[model samples]
Target chain A: MTWDILNIIGTIAFAISGAFIAREVNYDLLGGYVLGFTTAFGGGLVRNLLIEIPIELIWSQDYLFGIAFLGITIAFFMPDNWIGHLKKWVIFFDAIGLAAFAIQGADYAVSIQAPLIAVIVAAVMTGAGGGLIRDVFAGRKPMIFHSEIYALWAAFAGFMIGLDLMRGPYATLFLLIVIVIFRMISVHFKWNLPHKK
Target chain B: MTWDILNIIGTIAFAISGAFIAREVNYDLLGGYVLGFTTAFGGGLVRNLLIEIPIELIWSQDYLFGIAFLGITIAFFMPDNWIGHLKKWVIFFDAIGLAAFAIQGADYAVSIQAPLIAVIVAAVMTGAGGGLIRDVFAGRKPMIFHSEIYALWAAFAGFMIGLDLMRGPYATLFLLIVIVIFRMISVHFKWNLPHKK
Candidate 1:
């Protein structure tokens, strides 16, 4: 039940983010919908592909798709002033989405008995892959590659899960909180990975 | 035997094209190799995921990976003058790759009993998907969306194949030649789809 709720939150947050980007890029309604859907699900789609999950399985998540669609539609119709008011909240929601998706990805990998490295990769991919793809489609630089520290938190969660350091009912919730807090702190401090000169 | 040969030709051509783009973008050797490999295989990877092929099957194609690596290394080491001289030939090879991969993708979809629309999509995705991804990674608009009428040829091939209008021993060969010639002609004539203003 908790997993389902987290998934819904992540999907809605990503969809709104993607729709906002589409608006910024002057895309039409259809383009906005496409981008929104891709942003919500593209990460999981890529992860499933890597882990050998059937595409049919992904298609079965009709409720998630519906939620993403609703979020994008709402974002599309939102006025500029409303968007301005929500701008700060978007980041918080995005952090929540990131944490939830990252933990879910790690858990999935652990369930599949994937190696430690694979689990870390899966977490990063599931958490940030959608945004990476969304930026590519928008012809912008991928944020994860050059922005404030983000995917690292997902990798950290994956490492913890892979090592069996975090378990039990509250363990996931605790890790989610840690990742969300860390991501916000990094953003606030403008933390970034060192780039090669 | 024929399929294997076509696959090799396609892989080498794509790897060279990708490496050249990496050079144009001033990426390092590692980036060049990454782009080269992705350009050669990313389309098929996407197609496999869409069609529900297992990831293990893709990993089993070790020889194709080897060919792509070799091609990229050669491109990386080639003199700038040599690249300039070979620039004209790249398009021709790219057309061959597009035709071969498009046909291969359509064939795979048909084998899996996918619907006609799905088969057409598979063809276009396999033919143009890698280049689309490469352009995206390089932070450029996807060429297929705005460039000369390239993917249309792949779609044509798919339509023919899906409708079973082209079949028999020499059918694939015939379709391949037609797609290549049409692609070259389109490029030479600067044919393009009408875009929305």
Candidate 2:
């Protein structure tokens, strides 16, 4: 149940980012939905393929269509007011989604007994791939690759979840709280990695 | 030996069409190459995955990288002359690519023992997918969907190839001729699919 909520949360968060990017690009309804679809599934698609999951099975997954349909509908209907209002909450929503995806993906990789390094790699990619894709298609520099502490925060969140899981029901709420607090602090301080050039 | 030649012939033909479309869109160098790349590879990506080809092994097979590099180079350096001198040749070049892909895709499917219906579908997709993707990213209706018997020609070519392997080589050449002739006829008559209202 908790995992399901996180999945849904991630989907919605990415969807919002997708729609925002579309608005920024001045795409029509179909274009917006296409962007939204990419943003929501780009990460999972990469992750699944890397893990050698079959293509047909990915399409057949129930949550697949559910997320796509929801995203498309939102893009089609919410064009005018959505982009501006949505951008306001982007920092919060995106951070939550990133954090949730990081934790969930790390858990799945560990369950598959992936090597520790691979787990970290998957977790980071799963958390940031969607945004990177969205940024590229939107013709902007990706947040993670920028000096922003965005991907790092997600990585930290995923690492902590992995550590906690290795150690108890370890309240899912606690995980969420930790992610939110770190993200808020990071954004507040304009925290970022040091740049060489 | 024959397959290698046919594939290059097809790629050159497709590259011309890709360059033409990108030029039509007034794409910059990066955009033109990107469009050309999509035209060369989209269908194969879709087919390789669907046919469960252990795609990693087959992904870079044939003249993909060379042709792609050649195509993009042409799109960049040779585009102006190609567009100016050979406006009438688009139909022929596109026909060659489509026919070659149709035949090759059908043969590959049969070699893998796919159902005839599946073979037909794969052939059509492999022949058309790249151009379709190219069109989509450029925000235009796909050439086949918009008009002039392009996809139909692919179907015919694929069907002929799948009917028999030994005869398939001659049939591919025959299909190429047919597509070129028919496309020329369609262009003269200004034939097109009816626009949906």
Candidate 3:
């Protein structure tokens, strides 16, 4: 997928999840919006600060307002089953976002001559940062703590993007797609790492 | 008026506000602690970042566990009406905190040889940043935008502290006291800039 399309999907998916969680927690409209915006873009903000992106647009209100609209609109029409039946859908889209954004972040950081480690870190952050933040805002332990595969998936995507070993944009796109599918399958099947759960 | 005393007060006041505001919003125990810690120490996080301070403390279980205790203890024992009645008292101490931290911020920046304007901005932020973040986390426009003369009052104190002429510590402390009293009076009398409303 083109990066633009992927980004918009990622952003909207994030916004929706934040809205859904806010509803579960009974946040007010503005609070729901705040949660949405932070969930959608907090990773980007963290990346910018760490990677030296300008802070102006990040701090501005465009993305914030967009997420607020999404949250309120969702709340206005949501059914009781939306929360329970939608868990898998949220996770699937979330994995897609993680892969795409991780590649994007690694590319941007590497383009700026960031160290390899920094590239990996920034990539994983751009991918998983929003989810981590949403959990924090919702007062829940982050999925990253419970799910090891999520970060590792982002790292794999980031590694390919940063190393520039991929042949073309299609190759990079395929790498991201593989990571996304791999993560979804891993999560669905209850894959575990060496550490204790 | 010593910096240490002011620092302690600012931390405690912001922490209390965090706890109180979360309770007002009907947050659970963990949520209350999260809000309080974010309000009390978030500005210091930004301040440290601006000056390249490490951010490890924000995530330490020790800090988290401590803040949780601090908040839950207040929530457990304090009567619901207690904080509401102590609103004025909280504001008074908070103003002192603002003045103290603002000065501390400017002094630190100046010591690090940041530009004058940068130092000035840092001072203003250190004064109000915690409250601003608290507002964001709590889903409201920050109280600084309300009829409080708090930020400017802190700036005035910071100016005196970072004064190039080098006054005695006692003089700086006296200025902080003056700003605190002035701020309390302003808030009590509904004093505000005429054009703002």
Candidate 4:
């Protein structure tokens, strides 16, 4: 299914992003893999718990684990000089992963007949939980908490889904594109949430 | 029956430790409550998910939530001078909570007939997960990962329980006391894990 493809892509993208961050933070190779794996799967783990799904089911997804491992391995072996070039694309990939996971997370919550608030929370947590854990492991505040137009986009997607405004493959695809575009625009403009100075 | 009492004591102790950390880190009133609640309940949440327990069951424990909230509020209102004195006792309380949760967590895994590794993981995670999350939310490295004799005590309890070397109410109580004493001795001796400089 198209959803499965998107999920795989998101997993790989997030895994790579997590590995890159790990390297940037000077983590050892094992640390990089741990962070990468957590980034790719932590959200789903959280969503599964929230929806009362058996988390053992995640371990059955061999491809998910394989892809994350591959992504981290590749990131670890890449040339040092190429790191800067790759960094530019990390955000784009991260955004795609975020959008894909956000919609998918909402879908899971909806399937479970969770409340509206729970649906929105599932969306944001699924999209961002791995990254948040990654940052935590790296001893930094999660960037999404302070970043411009990050978690909000996921919340918006969840809102629309919970409101019954979006459904089906086409709607999901459309929303995904919109989220990616909006995230890029916000980043480009350096838009930020209000903070206490 | 005794386990329930120990559980309540552990929850209150962990919640207070969380609130104390939040105060030390200068979090707002709401942040203190959030951190306190997470520290008290996050371990159980992790344990439940891992053991395939329904997470909603946690909501049924109204008194647990009440205790955590009360602990945070009290910590928030403490006079500034008293804060330093309270910090000295936080570790002692934290060690008690750790032992209580570790035994409980291992017991849950044993009840479920989980593998030995899973039993050990459940024990350590249930004992340490909350504190790790507390540090993460406070934007610091988790102390257990870096500290000597912290996670080890939980692991020891788990190992003994899993190996059937310890059992029953009296055995659990004995292990708890031993863990606390060992932790305090390590702290007094300034024992720490070797780290790469």
Q: Tell me the whole-model lDDT of each prediction, alpha carbons only.
A: 0.84, 0.67, 0.70, 0.82
Identify the candidate with maximal DockQ: 4
Model 4, residue B155: distance off in Å is 10
DockQ values for all predictions? 0.14, 0.11, 0.06, 0.15
> Would you list the clashing residue pairs of candidate 4?
none
Tell me the deviation in Å of residue A175 in model 2. 2.3
Give the DockQ (C-alpha) for candidate 2.
Answer: 0.11
Q: With candidate 4 superimposed using the best TM-score fit, by how many Å does residue B166's alpha carbon deviate from the native? A: 16
Interface RMSD, all candidates in order, equals 5.5, 8.5, 11.5, 5.1
- List residue ranges in candidate 4 displaced over 4 A: A27-34, A49-59, A73-79, A193-197, B1-45, B54-124, B127-131, B137-139, B144-197
lDDT of 3: 0.70
True contacts kept of each: 0.18, 0.02, 0.00, 0.20
Scanning candidate 3 chain A in windows of ten residues, the lowest lDDT window is A55-64
Could you give candidate 4's per-residue lDDT for residues B47-141 as a string of tens digits?
78777767898899998788778878998788888878877677787888889999988998888777665677678879987887888888877
Report the Cα lDDT for residue A68, model 2. 59
Which regions of candidate 2 deviate over 4 angstroms? A53-57, A76-79, A161-173, B1-13, B17-38, B46-52, B56-79, B85-197
TM-scores of the candidates in the order shown: 0.61, 0.63, 0.57, 0.61
Best by lDDT: 1
Off by over 4 Å in 3: A57-68, A75-77, B1-197
Ordering by DockQ: 4, 1, 2, 3
